[model samples]
Target: PIEVVGLLNDLYTLYDAILRNYDVYKVETIGDTYMVASGLPQRNGSRHAAEIAYMALDILSSVGDFRVRHAPSVPIHIRIGLHSGPCMAGAVGVTRYCLFGDTVNTASRMESTGLPYRIHMSRSTVQALLSLDEGYKIDVRGQTELKGKDVEETYWLVGKAGFPRPLPTPLHIKPV
Candidate 1:
């Protein structure tokens, strides 16, 4: 229905702006699946991981105000997954841009295993964040199975240094 389209548009619109602030890139949004990336096209060093992490937190918190035109009372939830690694990206057929690699696949797994209203991340992503700063709050999610990959540890991104934890986000994700 048109209402669903409106909901998707509204969510994307909000997320896109927040991503821009963090210098993250919105690769595409297929239905409700929105894909994003950083440190690509032009490299930003390891900070790409941090940028994506902060952007994900921002977008997830924004969901608190997001309303579906069809159901304003229904709360919206989003699951964000982050993996830091290499990938091949470029505009493909029909000029549609794409990122292809196991990195993308593993990132997808992080999201699939993630719960609503949370930002799930791989250990690699955590390492990248720690490399840049020690102030990002993270919670251990323990080992999770990824398709084509053995069981691996994962985590939830709670908050970042110097930034107010997202408000009314239930968990209110604060630093530990």
Candidate 2:
């Protein structure tokens, strides 16, 4: 049990640092579900979506090499999802800031339905990423009905300017 806790802690630490590097804020981490956001607490226009995408890629790549302390041969995997739209953000509690709105919920839906080791995003986020005009490989996942929601166009954030399309997975990663 301790090993599990330690593994999660280390992973969280890694993510916290990575989020900072991308100028994104680590909103919270409930168990294995880590939440992050940008363009809030200080608005940065259309950069939030791209920032998240980059951070997600970095995290997924770094995770490929992150092995458990108890089992050095085993690597960790995570999923990421993004939805770009206006949301209400503020310090909800005494010391905790939070985001509320359809955007936040939709983003959560994207994450919950995402596949491991991949970044699943909505059309709005794809549009936001395109705003920068920096070529990021996006594979069309086509329209799908999300949980409790109508069908919507979804896409996968494959890679960006520096990261290659279909990021390289370690040999340790295998099909389920």
Model 2, position 77, has a per-residue lDDT of 57
Off by over 4 Å in 2: 164-176
Q: What 10-residue stretch in candidate 2 is worst by lDDT?
A: 167-176
Go through the candidates in order and give the C-alpha RMSD of each one to the true structure.
3.8, 3.0
Candidate 1 similarity to native, TM-score: 0.90
Which stretches of candidate 1 lie above 4 Å from their native place?
93-95, 165-176
Per-residue lDDT tens digits for candidate 1, residues 1-176, read 78888888888888877877886777878788999888876789888988898788777767877888789899886778899999999887985778999998999999887877888899999999988875888999887888789989999888887766563353444322
lDDT of each: 0.83, 0.81
55: Cα error in model 1, Å: 0.5
Candidate 1 local Cα displacement, residue 39, angstroms: 0.5
What is the C-alpha lDDT profile of model 2 across 99-154, one tens digit per residue?
A: 88888889998887777777889998998898888887799877766877888989
Q: Give me the candidate number with maximum lDDT.
A: 1
